[model samples]
Structure formats: structure tokens, C-alpha cells
Target: MTPEGKALLNIVILGFGFMFMFTAFQTCGNIEQTVIKSLNNFTASGYTSMSIIYGVFSASNLVAPSVVAVVGPQLSMFFGGLLYSAYIGMFIQPRVWSFYTASVLVGFGAAVLWTAQGNVLAINSTGTTIGRNSGIFWALLQFSLFFGNLYIYLAWHGHDHISEKDRQTVFISLTVISLIGCFLFFLIRKPDTSEPIPSETAEGLQAESTESISGSGTPRRSLCTQALDAFVKACKLSVTKEMLLLGLPIAYTGLELTFYSGVYGTCIGAMTRFGHDAKGLIGISGILIGVGEILGGGLFGILNRCSHLGRNPVVLLGLLIHYLAYYLIFLNIAPDAPQAPEEGTDLQAYITPNVGVALFCSFLLGLGDSCFNTQLLSIVGFLFKEDSAPAFAVFKFIQSIMAAVAFSYSNVLQLPWQLLLLVVTGFLGTMSFFVAEWKVEARRRDSAYDSI
Candidate 1:
């Protein structure tokens, strides 16, 4: 490819990457809201039903890593995209069982997309550039959430009063967009096949060497020796302590996902309690959050270009911002403040302070969160070999599990405790830096020994 052509290809791929991440998250957001709205419209008891749907969807996170490992990231992406498209269609004619089945498909597919995209970026980008690219990817996703909420708001505007035909029309439009997104997967060039492989003769020789080594011992002794050898190899390569450190920030990311997913509902509920018009407030808040994310992503990308400013500090700052955002949300939902509004007024005085707080928090959270996310990826890339997909997949699996637990816990706990969970997350986010530092020191020591 010419220089211009390669640059254009990169841009196109980046745009598609953004869209894929955006759609994955946006579709997940839409499903939850759509189910609740449909249930309310049908005058059916939906709390329990919706809870079950979310649980099944959340559980699918646990299996996504395994799927990626078995099928390869490219096929996994295709499967996820198709499954997401199908779920969108199923959502149009939702039933209790339909919602449940669809959630499972969507959740599983999302996991696949998440894993595949991370691997694709890692394979294609170098060092800090990976961080910049990841920031762009995440920014698009945040933008999607910002607008997706607006789409839901407009679709069900005066949802309490909309006709069934109007609702159906809105759902059909969303379904169409989702299907188009799935088709776009075809545009992603297959992952690079440039890495050289061992020839057949080399492989055969290696197999014979392995067999001769095994033949030197009796069967039982060989089995025992093999187990010991495998254990030692695992111990040498595996960074168990480092992995644990990484898990902390990942768990926090999971908490953030849970909070953000339910933020609209929380905002609406809080506004209603304060006698405000929640619909308008939510619409405005969503746009502000989207704008904030774009700014945040851009800022992070710029910082990544600087050698001195690195990933650790950026992540630390992001965690702090994320913590504050949730704290503000908790305050917005406090019970003692006010009453529901009188019937005729479109203006809601109760939401002014809440919206102001949320907007500021959203901007900070977006800036910090996206920065941290990019930094995390960079750290992982630095710490592991090129073929780190399995490790990445495992990390993501842990994140999904944490998110599932947090989401379920939110149903029973207050906002304050949920926000507290983020505090723990921030502390954990620092672990990657420490681990990276330790690994550097260890390598230095090993080099010193070899020199001696």
C-alpha cells in the first residue's frame, strides 16, 4: 500500500473500531431500557422479569473469554456481531422469555467483540500508540452511550402516552442500525498473517526430539517428570502477583460499567423524587457526558504522545475522577431532599443542582476513565509478549465477573456503598505501575548476574 493508502486504511479501521465498540455498548444499554419500557407499557410486573434478563445477560460475560480462546478473535468478532444483530431484532417483539434469550446472546457477543478488538489493537499498534488508539476506541463508546440514551429518550418521549405503533417504529429503527453495524464487520481486514511459522521439517524434528526425551524414562517416571517440568515452566512465566495487581483496576472498571449502565434510571428516579421533569434532565445530561468523553479521549491521546507523562499518573487521576463522579451521583439520589412535581409545568427546579453536579462529574470521569483504560492496555502490552490475547481475555473475564456481581449487588445496596467500591478500585489501579517497576528491576538484576 502507498503511504496515503495505508494511512487511509488505518483511519477507516479506527473508525470501524470506534463504531464496533460504540454499538456493542449502545446495544447493551438499549436492551435494558427497552425491556423495562416494554414491560411498563404492557402493564406487566417487570422488575423481577427485568432482573432475570439482566442476570442472564451478565452471566454471558463469564463465557466470552473461553469463546475467544477456542474460536480465535476474528471469528469471535463475526459471531458477536451477528448475534447482536439478531438480538436487536428479537428486542423489537420482546416477551419475557424473548428478553432473557436475547440478553444471553447480546452479552456473549459483546464479550467476543471486546476481546477481539483488544487483540486487534495490540497486534497492530506499537507501545504508547496503543494507548492513543485505545483512547479513541473508548471515546467512541462513551459517545455512543451519550447519544444512545438520547435516542431512547426521544423514542419513548412521553412514553407514558405514546401509541403502540410509534413505539414499534422506534424499535424497528434501532434494529436496523444494529444490523448495519453487524454488516460493517465485513470491512475489518482479517488480522495480519505476516508472522512467520516453523516449517514442517522443523516441527517434525521438534516432535521427535520431544519423544526421545520422553523415551529416556519409564512411563510413570516420565509422567511425573513432565508434570514437574510443566509446573516449573508455568511458575517461571506466570506473573501471579502482577495479575492480581491488575485485577484491582479492572474490578473498578467493572464497577463503573455497572454504575453508568444504571445512571439514567438513577437520575430519573432522583429527579422524580425532587419534583422535576426527569426526561429533559436526562436528555441534557446524556449530551454533556458524550461531549465530555470526546474531550477526555482527545486529551488522553495528546498526553500519550509525551514520554514523561506515561500511563500510571494518568490512571491514578482518572480513578480519582471516577470516584468523585459516583459520589455526586449518590448525593443526587439522597432521600431527604424533596417531593415530586406538580402536574402542568415542563420546567423542573429540583434537577438543576443535580444536573450541574452530574455534568461536571461526567466530564472528569470521561477524561480520567478513558485515560486510565488506555494506560491499562499499554501496561499490559509492556508487561506481556505479543501473543497476550489469552491474558487479556482472562483479565476481561474477571472484569465481567466483577461487573455482574456489582450489578446484582446494586439491587440490594445503597449508592454510597457502591461509590465506596470505586475507592478500592482506585487503589488497585496503582498496582500495574508497581508491577511494571518490579519487573524492570528484576530484569536489571538478571542482566547483572549474567554479566558477572
Candidate 2:
């Protein structure tokens, strides 16, 4: 198969794989209420799950590049997919042990999957196609968010509590979907032609224009040694000026996700802190997020193809969308503040973020999100195409840490404070990337000269 064909297939398979897991994650956002039904918890169940999940996930990046180096991208993803299914399987067991263990597995799996994905997409794409491919990938992945939320609306809309039957059914179904994602891994074509890239200077440039995941040559070392060497090399690369320029934006991916998926729903979706059930509303919001992602992805994808309207412009437009959504979301934060409201009545029903307005906010949030995520990945894939594994591993690591931090503070921080933080930090994140774009332009010029 042609490199482009393989790249397209991998992207599609990954989108399909993500659809199930994203849905599974979104379905029971607050597992304490839905699955565990814990009454004595201080932290929100959403935080509990995200912290556990991303905590482990972040830690695993230390080894992801090496793992990808040793096993190759396709097999790495296959293993990751297999482990990812365990997360959904946790729904069936619902035991504390099952939950935490699955969280670890899923976290490690996510690191592996993301590392492989970045490497795969980066390896196959050229400067010309990177932005479009990344956008397309993000667009396809949103189907999971859209359809998952749709499933929740269809199956559990009216009910406050999710039954074992409902949980189990969704679990079983998405589990199969995840397994299918793994199956697609087998279809990916690994490059058996490239020699060890002893020095990826000329070879790296050639590799980028061709099909090679490890742009650096593979040394004949033991698995542990290979991974250890990769880790050290990757770490050195991570601290370089070029890579550090991207830190803020990469970290923002985590914060954005945590807020959109976790905090926003908890704070604004309900009619009151404890009044109307927000599950249905949040589910609907997920659909809007998916809507925004697809639209943004599509727009960026198109613009990326045109030299006149490439990545930077779309990302700038995303900043506008993000700020707009921020104000829209602000409208939903009731002055009365959030209470556990698990059992009590909502005091300020009038101000609940559960109307068309909230939906609009959600749509904007999703739309805005597409710009950062798709573009960041594309930038990393293109700029560090030769070192895609390490660069992406670093990206994933920061992303996980930011997510964990967001979740940890989500409950303790006041609604106003959280929103304030997101606003300030999100702006910083985007601007950081904007600055990094200049560096990328310089690098691209260098690459063009080298190719010449």
C-alpha cells in the first residue's frame, strides 16, 4: 500500500478506536453517582476517575517512546488497544480494585496509543499534508463524543441513576468497539525497508518524506537498554528551546479537556447545584463538543490545504471561538455558587446553565478546542517529525499532568476561580503556540533548503 493509504487507514482505525473509549469515558462522567454511587466522597467522582486515569497515563510517557521504539508503532498501539478495553470492562465489574486497575491500564494504554498515533501520523505525513491529516483525525475522533453522548441521551436521559443493565450493555458494546480498534492495528503496515538511522540528519529528512517511525537508527541493544537509551535521548530533546516553546500549549490540551469534559458539566449543566438532573444536559453538551470539534476540524483541514489560509489563521480563529465560549460559559456560573446538591433542591433554578444558551457555549467550546488540539498535534508531527515519538511523548506527559492538576482542584476551587484560571491560562497557552509557529516557519525553511 502507498504511504498515504497506510496513513489514512491508521487515522481512520484510530478514530474508530477512540469512538468507543471516549463514549465510555463520557457516559458515566460522575462514576460515584452512576457506577459506585458513593455517598461519602469529598472529591467529585469525575475528578477521581480523571486523576487516576491521567496520573498513570502521564507517568507512562517516560517509557512510551522506548516502547514504540522496541515494538514498533502498530504493535504498540495493538497492545495499548488491548489494555484500553480493560477500562470499559471495569464497568462490568465495578469493584474498587477493578476501577483503579483499569484506570492504570487505560492510562498506560493511552500513552502507548498516543505515542504510536503521533509517530504514525507524523511518519507518514509531509509538511503539505500534516495539518489536514491531523484535522481529519480529530474530526473523526469526535464521532465518539457525539455518538456516545447520543447513546446516553437515548438510553438514560430521563433517569438520574444508571442501572447495572444500562452500564453493562454500554460496557459490553464499547468493549467490542475497542477490540475492533485493536484489530485494525494488524492492518497497519510497518516499514521493513529502512536501515538503522545511525544519524537522522539526511536520513531523518528522507525518512520524513517516506515511511519511517523511528527516524533515528535502531541500535542493537537489549529491549531495556534500547528503551533506556531512547528515554535519555527523548528527555534531552524535550528540554530544548524548540520543544519547550510548545509546553504551554501541550499542557493546555489537558486543561481544556478536563474543563470541557469534567468541570463545565459539573458546574453548569444542572438546573441547580442540586435541582434538576444535569446528566441529560451534560450528555447533550458532549454532542455539541463533538459538533464543535468536527466543524473546527473540517475548517482547519480545509484551510490547512491552502497556503493563503493555513494553520495559524485557523488557530487564531479558534482563540476567538474559545474566548467567546468562555463568556458564554460564564453566563452559566450562578452567583449562588455550587453545592453538592446531591440530595437537596436547587435554590436558583432560574440561573442553571441548562438551556439553549449552555448548548451554544458548548458548541463554541468544542469549536474552539478543535483549533488547539488539531493544530498542536500537527505542529508537533511536522516540526519534530524526525523525533515524533519523543516529542509527542513529552506532549502527552505534560498533557496528563495538566489534566490531573485540573481535576484535583476542580472541586475545591470555586466556580468563578476555576473559570478565571481557565481564561488566563488558556490565553497564555494559545499565545505560546502562536509564538512557536514562528519557530516552525524557520525550521520549515531550513528543511526546504535541506531538501534542495
Candidate 3:
């Protein structure tokens, strides 16, 4: 096969593999807080474990690029997949120690998995193809949400309460599904690194390819030194003007991601009065969220390939949709709905909470998320082509920190206040993104003029 054909194949394999892995991972994550909360009303183990996962994920991002450099993207991804499988397996027979330990390990796994994913996509794409590749991958990856939740909806739809036996059965099945994904990762053919990727600086490419050569044709820097250099390079890149400007939007993605993935589902689960099938609402929420994400991913991923509309407009549209979702959520869900459902006590909501509205809000949230992430990946791939791995590591680092902070407060903060925070952050993040886009365009024009 040609290099282009091979690149597309690798992209598909990565996306397909993640679809299987995250089907188990994300489904379990959506319900972790709720299920654990049900098991032990006295402890905040669920939210706390998630918080730890992101916290460790944030810290591990510092070295994720370094690890990718040493092991290469393929092995890095395979190793990360192994860790993800271990985390999912813990759900079958969860212990407090095992749960928290797995959380920490999975955090490290996420860092490498995402960093390696970015590296592979960047290596496989040029400026022209990054958007399409990102879109295709994202569209495929979101299918996990659909398949995973469809099972939940079917298994627990009519049942009011989930039995331990049912939970074990579901988790056992998911664990096996995740293992299949691991095997797929093992099958990804390594991309040819010899081809010159447009926009990558010679120096950056050389540095990434090796540490240094010796007079006797031996390596100069130790493997550990090379890894340290990668970490340092990532830190240096994180402080650049472009990356700094992009940080606001990147951080907002993390915050908004936590809201929909963790907090919003929790709120849905908490609403006992929504119907007799309150537990089932969580499954419905996941499925619709997946639908919304798939639509956005397909539109931006495929349609943009034809139009080349750039990233800014998609981000602006996402901002508007998010605003709409937040407003509806504020009106429909009570301020303290995420905390718990109270019986016989009147909840303070602007409108009576309708099940349809709550689920619709989830869809919007998912759609908006795809808009932000797909564009973010495209933009970063274009802007930092030479240093793709570090740039992606920095993006994940900031995003994970925001997610961790949001999760820490998810249980304590009221829904209204949380929505208010999102509104303010969204406005600022969108504006920051525009500034970054303008700067990049101006620089490109100047470079062209210089060539003339």
C-alpha cells in the first residue's frame, strides 16, 4: 500500500480500537459516581476517584511525550491500552484500594494514549488532511458512547434498581470487549517516519527522531536524557504565545467535558421524580450524547474536507450551542439536583424538569464538545506541526487540570452556579481562540510576503 493509504488505515485502526476500549471505559465512567454513591452514601469515593484520575492524568502529561518518544506511538498506545483494561476489570470486583489505585494508573494510561494518538495523527497527516483525519477519528471514537449505553439501556431499562449480579455481568462483558481493543492496537502498522511532513521544522524533527550522534557512531544522550529533553521541550512549548492563547479554550473543553461526562449524568441519575425508570435516564442521556457527537464529528470531519472553513467558525458555533444548553439546563434542573433527589421537598427550578429536556441538553452538550475538540486537534496539528507530541501533551495537561478541578467541586457546587461558571468560561475561551487564530493567520501572511 502507498504511504497515504497506510496513513488512512492507521487512523482508522486507532479510532476503531479506541471505540472498543472506551465503550467500556466511558460507560463505566458515566455511572461510576452514581453507582458508587449508591453503594456508600457516606463517602465521596466516586467523584474523588475521578478527580484523582484527572489529577494524575494532568501530572503525567508532563512526561507522556517523553514516554512516546522512547517507545514510539504504537507501543505507547498498546501499553496504555493494557492499563485501561486493568482499570475496567477492577469494576467487576471493586475494592476501595483497588479502585483508587486503578484510578491513578488509568490517569497515566490516558496521558500516553492521547499523546500517542496525537503523534500518530500528526505523523500521518499534512496540513491539508489533519482536519479530515481528526474528524474521521472522532466520529468513529464517539460510537463507543452509543454501543456502550445501548447495552445499559437494554439491560436496566425496565428494572428500577440494578442488582449486583447484573452489574458484574455487564462489567465482565465490557472487560472482554476492552481486551479485544487491546489486540487491535497491537495490529496497527507503524507509519513511515522518513517522509517530510510539511510545516515541521528540521530542527524539531531531528530532535524528535534522535538525541544526538557520537564520534564513534554511538548514541550521545542516554535514553533517560532523551526522555527528559522531550519533557523540557513540552514545557517550553507550553509557554509560547500561541499555546498560551489556545489555553483558555483548551481548559474550557476540560471543564465542559467533566460537566457532561461526569456531573450531568449524575444529575440525571439523581432526579427520582423524572419517572419510575430514573436509573434508565442515564442510559438515554449517553445514547443521545453519542448521537449529537457523531453528527457534529461527521459534519466537521467530512464537510470541512470539502469547504476548508477553518476552526474559528466551528468553535463560535459550539459556543452558541453550549450557551443554549446551559440556559435550558438552568431552567429545567434544580440548583441542587446534582447533589441528590429529595423526596416531598420542592426543588427550586425555573421550569418543571422534563425528562425530554434533560436528555436533549445532553445531546447539545455532546455536539458542542465535538466542535471544540475536533477543531482543537486540527488547529494544534497545523500550528505546532514540528512539535506535535509536546503541543498535544501541553493541551492535555491544561485540560486535565481543569477537569480535575471541576470534578472536585462537582458534588459540592450547585447546578446553577456550575452553569454560570461554564457561561463565563465559554465566552472567554471563544474570544481567546479568535485571538490565536488571527495571530496565526497574520504570521502566515507575513511569511508568504517575505517569500515574495
- Per-model TM-score versus the true fold: 0.70, 0.78, 0.87
Reference-based lDDT, each prediction: 0.52, 0.67, 0.79
In candidate 1, stretches whose alpha carbon ends up further than 4 angstroms from where it belongs are 1-14, 17-21, 24-38, 41-78, 115-143, 153-166, 188-239, 273-277, 307-310, 335-353, 428-452
Q: In order, how many clashes per candidate? A: 2, 1, 0
Q: Give the per-residue lDDT of model 1 (tens digit) for 47-144.
A: 23334434544455444434554455556676777766666566456675665676666666765576555554444444434445555555555556
Given candidate 2, what's the lDDT at residue 296?
Answer: 82
Best-fitting candidate, measured by lDDT?
A: 3
Write down the TM-score for model 2. Answer: 0.78
Residue 363 C-alpha lDDT in model 1:
60
Off by more than 4 A, model 3: 1-11, 40-44, 68-75, 118-136, 190-221, 301-310, 341-348, 448-452
Using lDDT as the measure, what is the rank order of every candidate, best first? Answer: 3, 2, 1
Q: How do the residues 1-452 of candidate 2 rate in per-residue lDDT, one tens digit apiece?
A: 76567666666766666665556656555333334442334333546667878898989877675667657777888888887777777667566666677777888888878767766665655555655666576666667787767766666566565566866776787677667767776766553323322222121112322233454554445557656765786788888887788898788778878888776665543444433445566677778888888888777766777765346776777778877877766666563333345432254423554467777888888888888887887788777766765666677778889999988876567666777777888778778887888888877789999999
